[model samples]
Target: MASRTTQILEAAARLVARRGVRGLRVEELATEAGVSTGLIYYHFKDRTGILRHTLEFINDRAERYTTSHMADAAPLAPRAELEEVLLLELQDAPEVRENSAAWGELRASAVFDEVLREDLARATLVWAQEVAALLGRVTPMAPAPALAAAGERLTALLEGLSMRWLSGGLELGHARDLLLGAIDAELARLQGK
Candidate 1:
């Protein structure tokens, strides 16, 4: 059986995705988690506490999701490996889309929330570092500084494309293509092509 804390966090993620972060209520969360409100408060001090764990929970899930995709691409070429990561990151299936959208909403909400802002900044850097390490594998010609910049750029591109794709401004394929294309182009440029 899932722990009560895990159950609460899972329900909180669904609630946050369905109804933005600020819309969650202790009563509703308790009902969804099938636990008493007091139990939730016991596990998490308050609403923000729940939200904090929920954010970490969602991020951890996403990283695991991305890692699953990365695992199979180990034997592929560097570019193909990078594409694997980007494709998973840009996946458009309902579950991935909803998770991405929820995270995006939280990112936006962080603008007005200091603690959340700090958490998001840290979470985002973890992702950026992951991409940078991926880029490091592919961009042999680029210096460390250049690779770092490229990684930051790639992360920005992913974020921009993801937000647009989530908003219906772009299709998932388009987002994936754009990201993969940028990766290829960056590698070529770094190779002095």
Candidate 2:
């Protein structure tokens, strides 16, 4: 069975994604999870604690998914490898999309919450580092700084695309195609240099 803390976090994430973090209520989360309000407090000290853990949970899953998806592409050319990574990042797995919604809520909350702001910064750094590692494997011509910058750019692009798709600005299929095409073009340009 999932631990109580895990259950609470998962429920809270779903609620936050659906209702926004500010709109989340402990009572609602507890009821959704089939637990009591005190159980939420037992696992998390308060609302902030729940939100922080929820963000961490989502980020952890994303990191794992990205890392695992890229694991087998190590031997491919840099451009191909980067394209594959971008494709994986752009493809919206249902769980990932839901988690991303939660992430968006957390990002908005970060504007007012110091803890969430710090968490967002940390998550961004982690994503940048992951992107840099993938880029380094493919783009041998660039210095580390340039490669890291490219990684940050790609990360930002994907994040923006995700937000747009989640908010119904673009269809999922179109967003994926656009992001993949952009990534492919960028990689080709990098490789041609």
Candidate 3:
């Protein structure tokens, strides 16, 4: 069973996924979490506090998910392992989809809310660096600058594709195909093939 704090954060993530940050209300969150507002405040202080913690919670979960998946993928080739990590955002599982939506909500809201920008940027940078590391593993001879550029491009594409998929603007299969195609193309270019 999840602790009260994790329960509240998970509820917050679900609300954020469905309604975005602007739609998240403490009372509704409390109700969804099956806890009192007092408990919510005790755990997180206020709505902003909740939002901040929720973002961190989501990022932390995503990192752990990727790490675990990558660990299980040790027998796979580097490119396959990279594909697994990149496709995580598009996974059909309910929790993965909800987390992707919540993260997307935070990323979109960060533009108008300066408080979220730093944390979102930090999360994005961490993801991009991970992508770069995977790219380095895939092509050890690639220059650092080139690997970083590829990472940034891939992450940017991922964000765009994920938003589209979440909004129903793109199909799941197409999103996966596009991402896999981009990965192949990027690796080919890196390899000078």
Ranking by TM-score: 3, 1, 2
The residue-by-residue lDDT of candidate 2 on 1-193, one tens digit each, is: 9988888887877888788877889899999899999978887888888878887787676666666765564777766766666666455676667767877776677788776666578778877788788777677675788777777888888878888988989887898788777666666766776
Best by lDDT: 3
Judging by TM-score against the true structure, name the best candidate: 3
Task: Score each candidate by Cα lDDT.
Answer: 0.79, 0.76, 0.86
For model 1, residues 152-187, the per-residue Cα lDDT tens digits are 888888888989987789988778879878988778
lDDT over C-alpha atoms for residue 14 of model 3 = 90
Instruction: Give candidate 1's error at residue 114 in angstroms.
Output: 1.8
* Clashing residue pairs for model 3: none
- The local distance difference test score of model 1 is 0.79
Per-residue error for 142 in candidate 1, Å, reads: 1.4
TM-score of each: 0.83, 0.83, 0.88
